[model samples]
Every structure is written in structure tokens, then in C-alpha cells.
Target: MDNLSQYIDWFRHSSSYINAHRKKVFVVLLTGETIAHENFSHIVHDITLLHSLGVKLVLVHGARPQINAALSGAGQELRYHKGLRITDTDSLQIIKQTIGAMAIDIEAQFSMGLANSPMHGADIKVSRGNFITARPLGIIEGVDYALTGVVRKVNAEAILQHLDKNSIVLVSNLGYSPTGEVFNLSAEDVATEVAMAMQAEKLILFVPQRGVMGKDGQLISTLSPVQADLLLKELAQDESVARNITLESLSAAVKASNKNVHRCHLISFADNGALIQELFTREGNGTLVSKDNFEWLRQATINDVGGILELIAPLEAAGILVHRSRELLEAEIDYFKVIEMEGMIIACAAIYPLDEESGEIACIAIHKNYQESGRGDHLMRALEKEARKQGLTKVIVLTTQTAHWFMERGFEPIAISDLPAKKQQMYNYQRKSKAFIKTLR
Candidate 1:
């Protein structure tokens, strides 16, 4: 396909995301390194596009690298305790100057409006103020952190008012005390606190790398809060890993997830258009820390045969699924996985290895009451995950009544002859089920 054709197709596919994000609140974090990178302009453009699409944005920026540079240039000693910067009187002054300058630069970037550029004709409004209230860290281990502080509260009402007026609220790492004292706060902490206070739909952190990587050197695309906590503990044991940015980013994601922020995304700031790609595309280009733990998907055992039967009985009676006896289900229980909610099986699917490189998915059924709530898609993903664990490269499904559903999910129609040899032989000639195949990545 030509570039224009691909762009047209992508635009068509992104319509759903566009509608979903409209009018939703998002809190975005930009670190000092991110703003200094060449791709900063592109990131700013994407943020502009999102604002144009009716997304209310709260931008929290950090000046860690810039502050460090300024302090070093000033012939000052840098001190840190337990991964938190120890900001003395002089360091606090330098931090305020550095953060002040960075915030102005970011606002200026948002004010760009050059013809022929992405921001052309986009008269965006940016608002910044003392939106965060902070308290001092006091002392730990008999050492005073001085001006280093933590977020005590966020002025969410003021931020929302600015958003209602169609302005993007810009926040800095500097917070103020009721006593009129300025305190240096961690950018990640500020971002998390703001997200929780605002109850944002998403808390997006622009990091240096693509996303969180496992010990195997591969990016983990999605994680639950429990899983993220486990990964955090595992990453903390390795002293070679930089604990400042990456760990803090992941830790912030976890904190937001636990505090009613539904989703937290960590994407690379160096990659141009990553913010747009992650938000608008189905296969997001980053790690998604989501709080979707209401239902559990697990491999089925013999004890779950009754629940599976109960869940699929209606489908079987309606000629949508092949009926299986309890004996047969118990025997093949190891090949099944189920979605259970509150000790009840709401969905179930089975993957049977038909060849060395292919698996057949069957008996996919969801409770009628839960059919419209994405349980089917959840079960399908579980089946695909099981197929990958078995080293299968392809998955086939035979559907007499749900061919359209499978086709909509990336499966393509195929003739019976295209099925694996064993599956072809076992195909019920009377049922005349249509075959569809999908190649796994």
C-alpha cells in the first residue's frame, strides 16, 4: 500500500479511540531529558492534537537534569539520600530557577503557531500556577532533607476550572507551603498526586526508554498492579539498574493505579509521535499499567467442568456450540481456560494443539448476561496466550454461527483443506463449520 492509503486506513481505524478519549482528563509527565530532546517538538505537537480532539490535559514537568546541570555549573555539591534529592538552601534556590526557566520554555513550546507546521492555526491556551501544596520531608536517619518536600495536596478544583475553559494546565515540580515557603518536589510524585486528586482517566509518563522491560530484555506491554509491584521488587534488587528515573516511573505508575487512576502509560519520549501512537492505536507502543483485576482468567481443572457446562449450556442448546458430555469435559479439562467472576465461570475457551505449529480454538462461550461486556474478547486473548505458551505460531477457529465475530478480530476465512491434517479429519461434516485462521506474532 502507498503511504496515503496506509494513512487513510489508520485514520479510519483510530475513530473509536478518538471518541473514547474525547472530553476525558489526562495527566502527562515530561521529564527534563524529554523536554531537552530533539523530539520534544513532536511530543508538543501530539499534545496539541489531543487538545484539539477535546481531551483535557494537565502537564506536569520535571527539571532534574536541568537542575543538576545548573548546580554543577554553580560549583555546588550534589547530595542525595535514599534516592531522594537533599535540597539545602542554596540547592533549593538553584532548583527554583531551573524549574522556573523550564516551565516557561514548555509554555513557549505550547504557544507555537507556525504555518505549515502541526501547530499551525492552533491557538492553544496554556495555564500555570501554584497548583500544588507541599510539606517538608523533615528528617530521616538524623539527616534533615531541608527544602525537599512531598506533595501534600493538589488544587484539583482550579485545574478543572482551567480545563473547563479549554486551557491546558501546566504544573511544575515546585510546590508551595501555607507559610509561603517553596519546596522542591519529585516530578513523579507530583504527577501521581495530581492524577489521583483529579481522578484522571490516564496518567502518562514520558520516559527515556520505550517502556518497562523485563529481565529477559523484552518490553512488557501490560501489567496489573500486583504484577507491577512484583516487577518493581525484582528490579530493585539489581544495583546496576538506574533507580532514579525508571524505577521512579514504574513506582509512580503503581501508585496511580492503586489510587483510582484507571490506567497509567509509560512511553518513550525520544520516539517521535509515540504519544499519539500509544493513545490512538490498538497495539500501543508502550507499557500499560491498568487496574482491570475484577475478573480472573486461569487454566481450568476438573472441578470447573460443572461451571463451564452451566455457562455454555444455552449456547449449546441454541446450536452455537458443540455439546460435550461431562465425562468428555473432565477428560479435556487441562486444555481449557475460564474467566471466573465471584466464583462463577462467566466465560470459557479451549485450545487444542492440532499440529506442531498450529492450535484450534473451540468451545468459546460466554454467559448471556455478560456477553456485551467484552468477556468474549478477554477469553479469546487467554486462549491465544495459552497457544503461544505451547509454541504454536497459528490459531484456527471453526464457527458455524460466529464467523463474523471471529473475522472482525483479525481472523480470515479459509477452506477446510487449509486446516491441520488431524483437525480436517475430525471436522464434523454435518455441522459444516466454517474455518478461519490467524497467524500469531
Candidate 2:
């Protein structure tokens, strides 16, 4: 009953804690559903906010309604046997046009908007590449699926190459085979295939209603594939999951999770800023499917500093963290935090106040043994805590490297002028560093 608005507020509270403590890359899947213009506008606004936050979005749009309209306009009746759309030649042609128009409309909307509409307020930098390889679905349940195809392969390299350029990758649920025939693939299937192949950090599917809700009217924030399967089994008998497309989208998510894609989320096309609420917040807007715990955020403390220093000292000596003397560290002892597991520190970061509502994150270091295991991320979040307790407005980091890691965690690189006087002075001294800032409020 609280709705996504409550979740967005919760996310804001948790950000100060998460940003200071963790550092890592994340991906999200945004599955599109045709909805009323007002709801579409709301969804667009949500996407804009997420885009503004520099969150990576992989958009997979569905044009079932558009396809239906095209089919009807072309004097063809739309039909589905079981869950599969009955597509003949006419249907396939309509699908291609409908999907192309939908992609253009999405681009147009993104182009028109200030944030979510375009990439970083420049041109329409989002890319819609040729990544899918298709194969005919043939027949299932004694019905011929015909030219209807399933995704056989995705060009993950091409997609990543485009994403690395800060461009959104738009996927049409239609693909072409080597034989030169077009096949209409399920939108859900396309989104999942790309996400799984790319090993996306997060996958999100958007639907008409507020996302996956319990019978009691509460949001199901997170669910594993097994749990979702059980829920779906009951819904199969009960009609409880509301929209059927949501079920389709979720089914795709479950399958994606079983593969390498670790996290997936479903959000409402009905709410404004829902994507931002889900991506930037702790407990997101919709139901999340993953193989692991998503509560991967927490607070950091002084006790975490010693081990954190151990991780950082090597990097510091190597000229990564600016050489700060032990006396200086003792003087700023309250600024450090570390990731602890079984009473051992594996990673660390430090936070220093920039202003009443802002701070500076520094000295991020991960032990080589635990380099990619998320320990460094744990420490970055700790730094976020120190800033929040001080009522900071934002946190900045100066890194000679690690831009990609910080970007994933929602930090934006800026010029030295963006920093406060004290931090700027320090930043200028460390001429080799690149500056990044994450808004705290």
C-alpha cells in the first residue's frame, strides 16, 4: 500500500550509507510494456532520473499493441494459441514495422528529454545495434510457430562496446536469421537473452501496474527463482499475478538468473522515477530476482580502519592513495572504514567532510587476495556513512584510476571546480587524480 514512493524515500536514506561504503558496477534490465500515454510519460520520467544518475540502461521494448494495431490496420486479425502469438507472413511484416516505430518513438522520447531522454545531455548517444541471431521456433504444442524465431545468439561484444561509450542499447524483440528471414521473438525472451549473455549486473522489466505485489498488497522486494517459481505455480491456479506480460517478463528473469546475470528487477510503468528508486536505493521499487542476497550494503566504522589501512598502504606506496603519514592518519582516524569477514579486513575506504551536507571519499583499497569479491565495495559504503552522519550534501573521490568502478556505484566525474575549497586544495596537490562526485541527498 505504501507504493514505490516509499521505496524511493528509503533509497535516499540508504544512499548515504551505501555510497560511502561500496564500489562496484551494476546492470539493470528494463522490459517495456505498452501502456496509456500518461503511464508511459511517468515511465519515461523514471528512466530520465535513472539516466541522470548515470545508471546504465538496456532497453528492450515490446510492441504487441502496436503490432496488433498494425495487424488490424492491415486487415489481419491478431491471434494467440496458448502463449505464443500466431504469426504468419503478414503478422511478421506488421511486427517489423511496429517494432521499428516503437524503437524510433523510444529514441524520440529519449531525445526530447533532458536526462532520461538522451545520454548526458549531448546528442542521442544510445545505440541500437545488430546483436541478435535468430532461428525459427518451428512448432510447439502441435501448432506451427512458422517464421517466429527464438534468440539463438546475441553479439555481447558489440553490445558492450556500445555501452562502454555511455550509450543505451535498444533491443527490438524482432531478429533476423542468416537465411534473411525476420522472426518475431518475445520481448521478454530478447531482453533475457541479451542480459544473460552480457552478464548484466541488474535486469529490470517494466509493466503496467505497480510491480509484483503480494495478495496482501505489499511489494515483493526480492525473490529467488525457486521462490518465484513457487509463486507462479500458485498464481497459475489463482490468477493472482495481475498482468500476464509481467509473468512472462518474470519468467525470463528467472531463467536469466540461473545463467550468469546475477540480479534482475521488475518495476511499474505506472510510477514516475521508479527506475531511479530501484537502482539508486537499498530496497528497490519492484520484485528483484537474483541468486544472491541484494542487501549487499551496510555501514562502516573505525574498527574497520586498521585492516583497511593494510589494504591501502601498498596502493599508497605505489602512489595510488596519496602518501599520508601515520600521524596524519591518526589525526583522521574517524574517516576510515573496512570490510570485515570472520574478523579479518579485506578492503577499505576513507571519508572526510567537505561540508555539512557533503564529504570526500578517499584511499579505497582492496586486498589482492579478495580483489573482485566485493570487499572494496563494502568499504566504499562505510565512507558514505561518515558523510551522512555529518549531514553532507555529496561525496567526491579523486582517483588516478577506477573511474569505471565508481561510475557503476553512481559517481560522476567532474572538474576540480566542483570540489570544496579544502578538498579542492588537496585535489590540486594530487594532480594525477581524476575527480568524481556522488550526490548524497
Candidate 3:
């Protein structure tokens, strides 16, 4: 019992690697089918948490359900064509109001952040634009689109300028065509166009039910575009694919990736901190799609730092990783675990025992060339196993970069004094060096 107590205590108290990496900017598509009050709260929490990170976010919201509800309440019937909504004259009017509610509701919720965690932080910039250009789908199989439209082009440079100035640009799926005609676009289309134009690091779509699965509320962590294309083929053949939000979203993501967006992520609005989970954790609370399965983690040996250093040099040069002298790595030689593919170490992490029963992971990183594979999670699980072997029950981390990551893995934050004595003595709380902890019990 004493041993168990000691183990649990250690698991709760060890610190995390705080200064691991720099902010990886991303554009997020926030859309959903369920428009309940509960979801509104989650939107607020997600924004506040991501804003806490230096992440540059562009929020695009979906309000089709809201618009439908409003229109229906006014005794108007909804129109559709080939699973796409037919936004005629009346629907167009409701779209503006429905989208306005989403933007306004989110803005009001942002103001509710804790005073210390203020909504109006120096980096907290949120704005919405009327910048979606659209063209009528013309006629599909003899069905006229009416006022329904497809996104023709996005003024992504405008959004990027706002992003460079540290603002969150909110987009509503409405646009005006070049011919002086107004049209409505799918939220998914709007997100994809913006991602392509920005050539974003990541493009994420937040939808309901996690991923494209029949199971209730399941989240798929990884998929390549080819795999997604095949699954979408199956979905297209079967109408029973009612829950396949993943496939529904793949069209735009594939287009964006083909246009040079590095990655695409589809997450649930249901997960409490889905945004953070997808962004920071190695195993995301969402489905990540890329052209291929890229490897980012490997088993580490004391000798791999030279190889690891080669991988991180660019990040250091980019001012993402704090430069360290060779002696510093040698002094903490036993702490690294690396990822190897083709017999070459591509990623590494530095893990150490904070005390007799406590472990701390530091300098956790992936080779940029090998990122987006599930290798990071594999490395973390290996680290967890090593901690268990050493009889440490608690693990803590200091992360200026991955707070949402640690949080998703069940790590919570407390004051530095909450750590075990030896670990606390090592704490270096920089503006970017936030803290986290996880238990093994």
C-alpha cells in the first residue's frame, strides 16, 4: 500500500518538458449539426485554451441547422439537392441571421474568460469578414442551385494579414459572386478555400460525432488521403452511412491538401477540449489526414543526440527550440528516447527520474521530416512504460508549447510547489514554460 501510495504520488507530481517547441499555427473550421446551449460553452472553452497558446487561429463557423430552425419556425420549408441545401431567396436571408448568431454568441462567450486568462490578451484577436466569393453551382443533373453556391475563391491574403497581426478571423459561409449576385456556400467549402489560399500548416474541421464511424462518439486518430478516398467511396455507395462525418468532410480537405496545406484534422465538438487535444497531444482527439503517414518519433539511445541535433537544428534556427550546448545533452544523456525509421533516428525525447519515485520528461520532440505519424504517441507510451519500470507513479511536464497535449493525456496543472522537492528545485517557469502532470495509477 505504501509503495502504491508513493507511485500514485509520483505520477501526480512530476513536471513536463516546458520549452519543447514553438507555436505551430493552424486554421480551424468550427462547424456542427447540434446547435444546443451545451455546445456553446465548449466553443468558449476551446477558444480560450487555444488563445492561451501562441497558436494563430482562424475560426469558420456553420449555422445551417440554426438557419433551418429559424426558417422553419417562420413556416418556410427547406430545400435540397443531392444532399446539398438549396439556399433560395428566403434561405439566404436566414443564413445571415443564423451565422450572425454563431459569431455573436462566440464573441460574447470569449468575454467570459477568467480575468487572469483574459479574452482580450495581447494575442487574442478575433474578427469576422464578409470575404467569401461564390459562384452558382449552375445546374446539377437538371436541378438549379437557385441561390445556393460553391465557394469560387477566398481572399486568404486578407485573413493572413489579420493572422500576422495576431487575430482570429471568423468566416461565415456566405459570399457574393463577381456578377453582383449574392450566394451561400457550404461551411466546409469556405474552410477548404481559405486553407488552400493561405497554404496553411493545418486545416481542421470541427464536426459532430468525432470521425467518420458508425459507432457513437468514437474518434479516429489517423488516416491518409487515399484511405479517406476509399472510405468515401464506400460511403457514397451506401446511404446507411448516416454517421460518416469524416467522409463528408474529406472532399474539401483533400482539395486543400492537394493545394499544399500540410495537414488536415477533423475533431468533435463533443470532446471537452477537442481543439487542444487535436493540436497538442501526440494521439489527437481527432482524425488527422495527410498525403502519407509521416513518422515523427523513435526509440532513443544516448548516442542519438548527434542525429537528433541535426533534426532540431532548423527549429532552433527558427527560434522554436532553445539552443543548448553539447555538454547540456551529455549531462542528461539517459533522458532521451528516439524514433527510428529506415534504421535512422528521426525524433527524440529526454526523460529523467525527478527523484526516487518521480519521473519527468523533457525536450520531447519529433523530427520535422517525420512528423504527423502516430510515432509521437508510441514514444510517449514507451516513456510511460519506462516510468513504470523505474517504479515512478507520477510524471510531470513543463511545456511552453503543449499544455493542451498534457491536459488531453490526463495531466492537470498546479503551482510549482505542488511538485516533489527534487523536481520543484528544477522548475524554470518562463512565460512559455507552463507546467503539467499525469499519474500512472
Across residues 1-441, which tens digit of lDDT does each residue of candidate 2 receive? 587888777766866744532322234434444443466765665565555455566777777766777889999987787767878987787787777777787887777635544334545466886789999988887889887789999998888777667777788888889987888888888888888777777677776666776778778888876677667766555543346767776787778776656777788776777766676667767788875752233345555555556667888787767777656766786666655544556556678777666778877776664466455666766677667767776988888868889999999989888677887765555356888889875
For residue 163, give model 2's deviation from the true position in Å.
0.9
Worst 10 residues of 3 by lDDT: 13-22
Q: Model 1 over residues 1-441: C-alpha lDDT tens digits? A: 699999999999999999999999999999887898899999999999999999999999998889989999999998999878899999888898888888888889989999999999889999998899999999999989999999999999999999999999999999999999999999999999999899999999988778988888898999876678889999988665344477789999988876668899999988988899999998999899985765688999888999999988888998999999999999899999998765778789999899999999999987764564466888888888888988999999999999999999999999999888999888999998999999998
Off by over 4 Å in 2: 1-37, 113-122, 238-241, 294-441
Whole-model lDDT values for every prediction:
0.90, 0.70, 0.70
- The sequence of per-residue lDDT tens digits that candidate 3 reaches over residues 61-124 is 7776677789898788888877788878877777777777777876766556455543444335
Q: For every model in order, what is the number of clashing pairs?
A: 0, 26, 23
User: By TM-score, who's the top model here?
Assistant: 1
Winning candidate number (lDDT):
1
| lDDT minimum window of 10 residues, candidate 1 | 238-247
lDDT against true structure, model 1? 0.90
- Deviation (Å) of 47 in candidate 2: 2.6
